[model samples]
Target: MSRVLAFPAGRRAKWLVLVAWLIILGAAAPFAGKLFGAVENDRLGYLPKSAESTAVLEQQEAFPQGRVNPAIIVYQRDGGLTAADRARAADDQRWMAGKYMPKTPPPPPTVSKDGKALIYQIALVAPPDKQEGNYVLDAVDAMRKHIGDPGGGLEVKVSGPAGRDSDQFLIFRDMQYQLVLIPVIVVAILLLVIYRSAVLFLVPLFTVAVANQLGSAFVYGLIKNTDLVINSMSTGVLSILIYGAGTDYALLLISRYREELARHEDRHEAMAEALRRSSGAVLASGGTVALGLLCLFAADLNATRALAPIGVLAVGSAMLAMLTLLPALLVVFGRWLFWPRAPHVGDSKRAHGFWTRMGETVQARPRRVWALTSLGLAVGVLGLLAFNVPQQTQFTTTPDSERGQTLISAHFPAGNGNPATIVANAAQADQVKTAATGSGVVGAVAEVGRAAGKVQYAATLNAEPVTAAERSAVHRLREDVHAVNGAEAKVGGPAAIQLDQRDTNVRDSWITIPLVLVVIFIVLLLLLRAVTLSVLLIATVALSFGAALGVSTLVFEYGFGWSGQDSQLPQLAFVFLVALGVDYNIFLMSRVREESRRHGTREGVIKGLVTTGGVITSAGVVLAATFAVLVALPVVSFAEQGFVIGLGVLIDTFIVRSLLVPALVHDIGDRVWWPSGLARGTRQRAERGRELAPDKSR
Candidate 1:
């Protein structure tokens, strides 16, 4: 990866070419794609065809589809409906309809019983088809802005796929500002605060910026060649990868530079030694995270599979930067980078009474501490029982929150809001039609037509559309149609779609979670050589994930008033909760196992917690905070995802890693390493490894 871009001698001269090349290439490729309109394809294109996709496409072809784009035009009669208000509303609707505008015929208006709420459903040229209509999002912005004002009796809240895109565009823009700007500002402040030197403080920022540029270019190249579903969230992932991991590497390099300077050695030797010593840890840490992300491939969902490689590329780039560019820059700047307060080479440890006391308490009463922590996590995990899978196609749309949707809900039967369709085929046209209009169902038989080999019917139900009741109706409709004599029927609609998605998600979860756990468990066991330790670590991750999901359910369902989280959220949460959460667990446990070699189990847990706890805690806090920024964005799905992950990190770091693990380690004593053949071997090896590096301390 490092060899993809050559190393240069003079910093300013080298960076100038790098910057120019990136700008030109990044601008050109996407513009070319848009002009040519070539569909982006991926390696997954090679996968075998699925029966589900074939069924879905066959169903889609049966409809002489009405306008697919769903539009919401909300009218707020903030002032009571008067003559003037009514006139203005009528006029606006006429103006929208009269011109040969891009918009399609608006659906009939559904008014509130009290007359304050009014919504007109507008249709778009087409629904969101990936290839042809992505540009519709751009066209829909004009409608939303028109609704933002109070010109007509209706205060329009135009939403659909187009509205979602507009919302996401704005949200991503804001996130880019915060994710990039805040980290830069925070890091700058911390650098100055810690180093008390303006020049040295800026050095890390400069190095990180260059690293980000190259990393982005690499990702852009991959995106061009592959059909990854890169979205706004990719921006945050890239920024964090560069800033968070880059800082850790910079800290290691700068620390070494200071140590060598204080030893009165030259800059080059100091940097070489720092690179040699720190590179192993840096490589191992980055490799662990990259491998953890790769586990997302086990997911049946396209989203996870898409994101996995992007994350790997970004992290891998950071690792390269840490090894090459950072070291080179450190060599160039020398000890003067730490001017003013200057970097120190003395004992790096700082005493903290609070952590020390906490550790001693756990060491004294391990059983009590373990019991309390376990009970707390169990209570939190109970929230998972109420976990609701969101019904909408897009995560941002919610039935309860939008007044336009609520108005639609009231006037239209639940199933009518989004109707499931059935396609029936039989030898006799009458039999197919009979199956299509079969009774004992929630939906009203709205339309029936006979085609060559199939009878198509669009059904709108009497219940709330896409609700549990509506899904039941859809299922019943399919069952009833299939039960008909000499005919076959297939069902598809929003409700049916939900059922399909739910089924897919459940299947994916089962497949991915166990696979990820087994892989991670095996890796940790091999790394540590203790079965008991592996079981404890995996269990901790599982508990942490459950607790996180439970809390997120409360936030999304009750606090934020969202319908529910995205269907894929649980699977995504499990991926992060297990993978990243266990990454920290491994870091903490490795330290603990090292300490356990020297002292007894009770003493070892405490020593490990005291030694590596701060670093792990800091990493967790940063990761959590970075993810928490998702909540501030109005996209409910991403918000739910971010909140779940952020909460997981917080709980894992402060509550589980800091408190629970230590208590369990202390309570178990030698039993913590039991049921594993390598317990004695691990101890012996740890002892020998410690002796080989006796002068160094964690």
Candidate 2:
């Protein structure tokens, strides 16, 4: 393992590694640019596989009209629409019908009860051969263009499935570039600040950029050739993960190499020693994260399940680049890369610094420090009670679809535009329709189409979409139709999809959280070679996750004025926080164990804290800042994830790793390393005595 690690830093091998990476980058660059084009943003991609809505979606393809993407053009005049307004609306409707639905015309415009608004429902049938995202984008773009400016005081906007889907597609399309650019910029700035050298930060940044490209290309291949399902959300997260994790690994390796440079004259020897010392932690950290992400395969939601492979590939690419490319680059550049503050052989290492003082403070009041910190974190967990799944579209900025939905809600039924869909046997269609209408929750039911003895019906709900009432209404409707003999009925649509997503999120959280915890515990045990410390570290990270979520909940509701969060937030947040948060603990505890073999446990704790503190904290900040870039996106879910994950990393960096974990280990002493020889305290005592007897020859 040492030979392999050092191979990249060899006098001749360094260039070989660089050349190999350049070749790989060249091959990956073209595929990387095509990754976004392969993203599956269809409605079914976000729904649960076992969901009734998913079944409906599959069955709809057989219908004569196929699956319809409804686009509702809403025109409202506060003082009541004039004859001219009505005429123009009719003309626009005719034009849309002629262009989109040539054979079948959409229903006539419906006036609101208050006579202030009008809505024209246009059914834009999706072509079976075309991609859903692109089709929706083109159709909505044409509709919006045809309508142009309203001219009068009348408001004109597109809403419903087609309009909303187009908006979502637009956000994702725009995000493809922003996700890559913003994270790169964030990592670059943080790296510069942390390194404080003009040239030093570039090596890691370039290495991580290569990792990003490789990850993108790899994911693109999986998505294009395999059964893997990926969405815009998954792609966005993959970009962030590659840069964040890759840069973190780079920081750790480089920091260790710098330390070794002060002791070794040969740059190659310095890098070799650095790699041998730090590679284990880097590999273990990457493994823990990759394994944790693998648990996502247990998720029923397509989007969540897709993240498993995507995340693992990202981590693997990052780990490969950092261990190989970064090491070679550092050796090739030698000590001059650090420039102004470069370390030299025989130079005295700084023994007292900010982290050293922090270690002393922790050592002074171990119990008090941990107790107060634990209390503070526990308080933050109270915010979890406020967590609520968002009932409306998750967007940071309002779009045309949202505006149209608001108008429709004010003037028509709250669920006016987006209606629930039901599929049933044609033999029992009449009975199913009657049952559905009599369910009381459904306002009306109409036959949409029929094919292969299966009939499709559109059921307009009396309740708004994505609410408790809407869920209950869909449930009742399904039950009512299922009671009809030989109907084989199922309920679906926007409301049903949201309900299924919520339920799937809950189930996934239960399964993946425990699985991830187990994976992390096993990794920590193997890495630290101690049982007690592993459990303690997992506990601290778990606490950090809860506190981060709790604080995020409070901020979302009170600070951002958001009513609720994305359904997937809790599960995604937990996986990332536990897996990534434990990384710092691993770095600290591993170093502490090595030092404990030479010094006593208490002294080892201080030494480890002082040694690894800056690099780990810098790593945490870089990771946090990369995630923080998500807040700049237009999607609310991405923003919430960014804020919570970023906050959790900060808490882990500053409080848990720095104060809580160190203080607890200090208070417990050698016993913290139970089941290991270090726990016996005999070796620790001998080492302490040997240290005290040092310099006797002088």
* Residue-level lDDT tens digits of model 1 in 389-431: 7444344544222444454555444443454556666364466
Cα distance off (Å), candidate 2, residue 634: 2.2
Q: Which pairs clash in model 2?
A: none
TM-score of each: 0.78, 0.96
TM-score, model 1 to reference: 0.78
List lDDT for all candidates, in order.
0.62, 0.88
lDDT of 2 by residue, 167-265 (tens): 888888877898899988888899889889999999999999999999999999998898767888899999999999999999999988988888889
In terms of TM-score, which candidate is strongest?
2
